[model samples]
Target: MAGPVILLVAAFATLVAALLFGGGAAPLVIADAGPVVRWGLPIVKLVVNLAAAGMLGALVLALFALKTGERAFDLALDTASVSAAVFTIGSAVTGFFTFVNVFNAAPSADAVFGDQLGRFLVDTELGRTWLITTIAGAVITVLAFAVRSWTPTLIVALLAAAALVPMGTQGHSGDLANHDIAMVSLVIHIIAAAVWLGGLLLLIVIRPVTDRAPMIAILRRYSAIALAAFVVVAISGTVRATVAVGDLPSLLTPYGGILLVKVAALLGMGLFGAWYRLRLIGRMAADAASRHFWILVTVELALMGIASGAAAALARTAPPSETAPAFVRTPAEQLTDAPVPPELTFDRWFTAWNVDLIWAFVVGFGLFFYLAGVWRLHRRGDRWPVYRTVLWVLGMLLLLWVTCGPVNAYQDYLFSVHMVGHMLLTMAIPLLLVPGSPVTLALRTIRKRDDGTRGGREWIMWAVHTPFAKVVTHPLFAAANFVASLWIFYYTDLFRWSLYDHLGHEWMTVHFLITGYLFVLSLIGIDPVPYRFPYPFRLLTLGGVIAIHAFFGVAIMMQTGLFAAEWFGAMGRTWGPTPIEDQYIGGGAAWSIGEIPALILGVTVAIQWSRSDDRLQRSQDRHADRTGDAELEAYNARLAAMAEKDARAGR
Candidate 1:
């Protein structure tokens, strides 16, 4: 009760103080929504943010740390359900306030007001975003209350997380210069903060029902999650701030000042976490240490409250550079919300970079975790192949390059470059990734828990053995999906969607990468799977897929018209090939450069097949040596008896 009380009070206190200091919710001189509407909006928004964090974080921790049918698990779900309900109400109120603020609508029971509100909800992007968010919150509320099992809870958690995304798009990010970067950063920031904050609230909520030993265990698991969440939050928040603030001097502005306060609070919380991880958590099972731990936790909660409040205030405050509305100066800027890059050159292929912070972080963490796993194996006196690590590193580096380097820099302006990236993502990178057998490495390295809770290792194992995994990893299905994705993506409205929507582009990248990885894994992966086809069948599958892929490439090459003509044709690129010519080069890259990886897969499979046969023959030879050729003698005697019977028949 004290902890929760302290958190809420501190949060509201900090929020009011910051809003006053920054004049974030100050009444507008030109289009004033009155003090009540102006003040109420940020307040309601704060509630929405906190409720959202509580819902998503508790659900995620429930999945990762709590055992099904346990008291703590049920309590966590109850917390999530209640938080989701608050989130729903908060979102509705926030939407109403937003409508009032944006349209200067007065509170009324008149039919005209109702009609206008209805139109706003259905007719505008802002209205639709909030409507979707509110609906998603309602759905999560019901699902969180109803579902106690892992998979269902996971679904609810995902829905809850998605509900936060609409808010990210609503912020200054949507109309900003680096819209994608800012949006991605905000999305990741909110999600990670929720996990970190909500998990702590869950601990306090569930503390009464848990024994000390189990509580400590749960705390340790949560600490690990918090560590990861904190890293993500810090990184995403930094990127987002960089985008919004624009320059270092902007830190003197109202928004930046509030942002600095939030950063300080976060840093305080980080220090508290370090203290817990390094000293307090280990000794907290004892009485005095337990009391001390709770004291520090309370302080941490207060810091989190300050951070959260400052964040809400910062949201309402305008950045230094956003004093005027963004205006598009060209077709390219209008289409991409960005200026066109300088013409692509051969040197730019290696020198240029347009970093997707998402993939950059992904590659960074991927390398770190993979190497950490290998190091763990070495420390335990276990042997892991050096070649596997090399391949894995190469694959991750290629992924980073494809996602963040020149391929990404020019992909929007040049179809050929986009195709080259697609080829690498779909075919080349997977060839290196599959042979590394990351799953095998993880299983070998990650500590197996005796407790009922699922950790990374347990979850990975569960996912690998699921029925869905079996179907997707099947050789035939994987191959079909791998080849069909290329056609389906390019031929349908999806191509245009990817060009227009940042989320769609990310989805395309993920879909291609997964399909490619699955196909390669089915063909020649060293990782354990539910099923793998025979070597000869694998070769046949590869051959059939190769033929179809080549045909698809040829089909693309033969297209007389441009794909996504509105987007590609409108780029206004003057230095490079024409749209049709670039498309031709893209098609050629698809057919030729892409096939090299397929050939590599085919060759690798052949080598594996040959080795498998050789191993079988060697095993038989060892058996023959142990039996001293007695089976051969018995076969000869049987043949002689058959010959004698034939001779008798002839007489």
Candidate 2:
């Protein structure tokens, strides 16, 4: 109780001070919106952050550590319900203030004001965002009150986390040069911060009710989660700061200075956590040490308040220009949010670079966990195939290149380059990934839980055995999905959506990768599957898929009109081949580069089939050796008996 109260007071004081000193209050005077809307908006948004953190963090702790029917678990849910109620109120208040701030309209019950407000909420992007966030918060508030079980509470937590997305989308990044990257970074940062902050608050709240043993266990689990959150927050914060500060010298600016304060506070919290994990947690069993632990937690909570408050102030501050010499953008730059590069060259494939922070983290975490899994196997004197590791690493590297390199740089403008990336994601990368047998490796390396608690392995196994998995992994279904997506994606509005929306682009990548993976898995994968077609049927399926794929490519090549002409044709590019010619080249690449992986799949399936036959023959030979060819001898005896009966009948 003291910890939370102190945290709130410290945060509020810091926020007020930063706003007055950091130029955040300038808007009130400049816009003449008065103190109520100006001061009230940031304060309400701050409370929204704190309450959202409490709701999400408490739910995370309950899911991971608290047992059902336990006092601590029920109490945690109650805390979540209260926090969600506050979140709902805060979000609503923030939404209303955002309207006043954006429109500079004083609050009134007049029909004119109401009509304007209605239009703002229904028609404008910013208004719609806050409206959605408020609605989501309301839903979570109700669900949190009604739910006490693990799964239901988990759903509420997810909803609560998702509710932050709209707010994240409206951050300063939306106005920046790297809008997509900024949006991704801000969203991840918000969610990770909530989990980290909320978990710490819950720990303090439940300390009195929990026994020492259970408390320690809960602390250990939370420490692991917090460590992960800290890493995400650190990386995401750095990415966001780079965008916000723009250059090194800008750090002396007011906005940058406030950001630095937040960074320093984060560092202090990190150091405190390190000391707690390394020096204090081990001694927590002692009465004197436990007393010191509470003191340490109080100080940590104060530091967290400082960080959160500085963050709120930083949000209110204006960022430096990410684009230098701000000038009118060309149509190409307007569409892509970046300048057109030099003419495409062979060397440019390796030289061109565009950093997508989201995919970078994905690749980094993927590689780290894979290597960790392999190391776990090695330390236990278990043998994992070396090729699998190589293939998985290679696949991830390909994924990184496809997503973050030249392929990503030109995909919006060049149809040929987009096709190259699409083919790699769908065909080449999955060829390597499926052979890695990641699922088998995970099942081998991850420990199983016996206490009816869900863990990584349990969740994975559950996913694999679910009815959805069964249907998706079926050979005929997988083939149909693979073939159908190529048409549905390109011919329908999905193509336009993917071009215009970053989220849709990401979905397209993931969807293609999964469909390709499933197709390959059904054909020649090393991992155990729910079902696989017979070798002959597998060959037939592969052949049919190849034919359809080739026809699809041919259909594109033969088309006279350009697909996605509005996007690809409107890039105003002067250097590349014409859109129609580029589309032809893309079709040719699809027909040619795409077949390489299909050829590999064909040969792999054939080799496996031959190996299957050889194994069967060897098994038969061993049976003959053990039983002296009893079946063959019995057949000969029957022939002799028939001959003897024939001779006796003749006599």
Candidate 3:
């Protein structure tokens, strides 16, 4: 009780101070909205963030670490429910205040203002964002109250997490030059911060009731989570700062100063975490050390408050200008919110770079966890293949390049480049990734969770055994899905959506990667599955897929008209090949670059088949050695007896 109260008080005080000094309410003067709205909006938003953290963090801890039917677990869920209720209220308040702030309409009995409010909620993008968020919060509040079990609580937690998405989308990202990256970074930042803050609060709340051993275990688990969150927050904060400030000089400005204050708070928390991990946590089992731990936690909570407050204030502060001076806008710039790059060339493939925050994190975590798994295996005297690790690392690196390098830079503007990326995502990258056998490694390394809770290993096994997995892993079905998606995506509005929408692009990437992985896995996966085709059938599957793929490519090449011409043509690129010619080149890439991976898959399947035969023959020879040729001797004796009987009957 004391800890939470302190956290709230600290958060409110710092938020108020930051807003007063940061000029966050200055726009109210021009908008003619009273100070109540000007001041109330950020305050409500801050409370919303805190409550969200509490809801999400408590649910995550309950799912991941807390035991079912335990008092601590129930307490955590109750806390989540209460937090969600507050979140719902806070969100509604924020939305209403936002309405007042944007329209400068005071709350009154007038029907005209009421109509305007109704219109704002339904028709405007901002209104829609808040309305969706508020509704999601309301749903989460109800779900959290009704659900107490692990899986149900987990679902509620996911719903709460999803509720944060619209808020992420509505951030200052749209005003920034790197809109997509800013939006992604903001989303990651918000979620990670909530988890970190909420987990700490839960720890404080449950400390008194938990036994020492279990409490220590919980603390250790949470420490790892907090460390991960800290890293994400740091990286995302830097990206956000870069987007908002634009230059070093801008850091001296009020907005930048508030950002700096937030960074400082984060740094303080990090240092405190280090001390807690290295010094305090080990001693937490000692009666004397408990007081020290509580003191440290109190200080840490205060820092969290400061950081959260600064974040709320920073949201309201004006970012530096995103536009360049005296720069003429191109059609691409108008559509994409960024300037067009130079024409694609061989050199540009190596030189062009766009940092996709999402994939960057994906690759980073993939490498870290995979390597960690390998290290754990080694520590336990198990020898994981070095080549598997090497292949996994290389595959992830290629994925990063495909997503964030030249391919991503030019894909929207150039059809050929888009095809090149699509080929890599759907074929080349998966060929490497499938051979890495990530599932095999996970099954071998990740500890089993048997407490009626889903952990990494449990979830992976469950997923592999699901009906959807069985259907997808079937060679014929996998091949069709792989080939059909190409036709459907390119021929339909999906391609245009991918070109125009960031979320659509992400979905395209994920869909292609999964389909490709399943196809390759059906052919050459090392992990256990429901069924795998024999080598001959595998070869036949590959052959049929390749033939269809080639025909699809040829169909594209023979087409006289451009695909998604509205998007690629309208890019207004002056230096690249004409849109139709670019489409021809893309067709060639689909036909040519796409074949390389098919050949690789064929060769891999052949090698695996040969190995399978060799292993089978070896096993038979070992059985012969063990039996001393007794079966062979018996067969020869039986043949001799049959001959003797035939001779006697003839005589």
> Which 10-residue window in model 1 sums to the lowest lDDT?
320-329
Highest-lDDT candidate: 1
Model 2, span 250-269: residue lDDT tens: 99888878888889989888
Q: In model 2, what lDDT does residue 99 have?
A: 85
- Can you list the residue pairs that collide in candidate 3? none
Off by over 4 Å in 1: 326-328, 629-651
Cα lDDT, model 2, residue 314: 76
The TM-score between candidate 3 and the true structure equals 0.94
lDDT (0 to 1) per candidate: 0.90, 0.86, 0.87
TM-score ranking, best first? 1, 3, 2
Query: Alpha carbon lDDT of residue 580, candidate 1?
Result: 98
Clashing pairs in 2: none
**Per-model TM-score versus the true fold:** 0.97, 0.93, 0.94
Alpha-carbon lDDT of model 3? 0.87
Q: Candidate 3 residues 558-601, lDDT tens each?
A: 98988876677788888978999999998999999889999999
Per-residue lDDT tens digits for candidate 1, residues 251-343, read 998888999999999999998998876798899878998898888889999999999899888888877756454554687888887778998
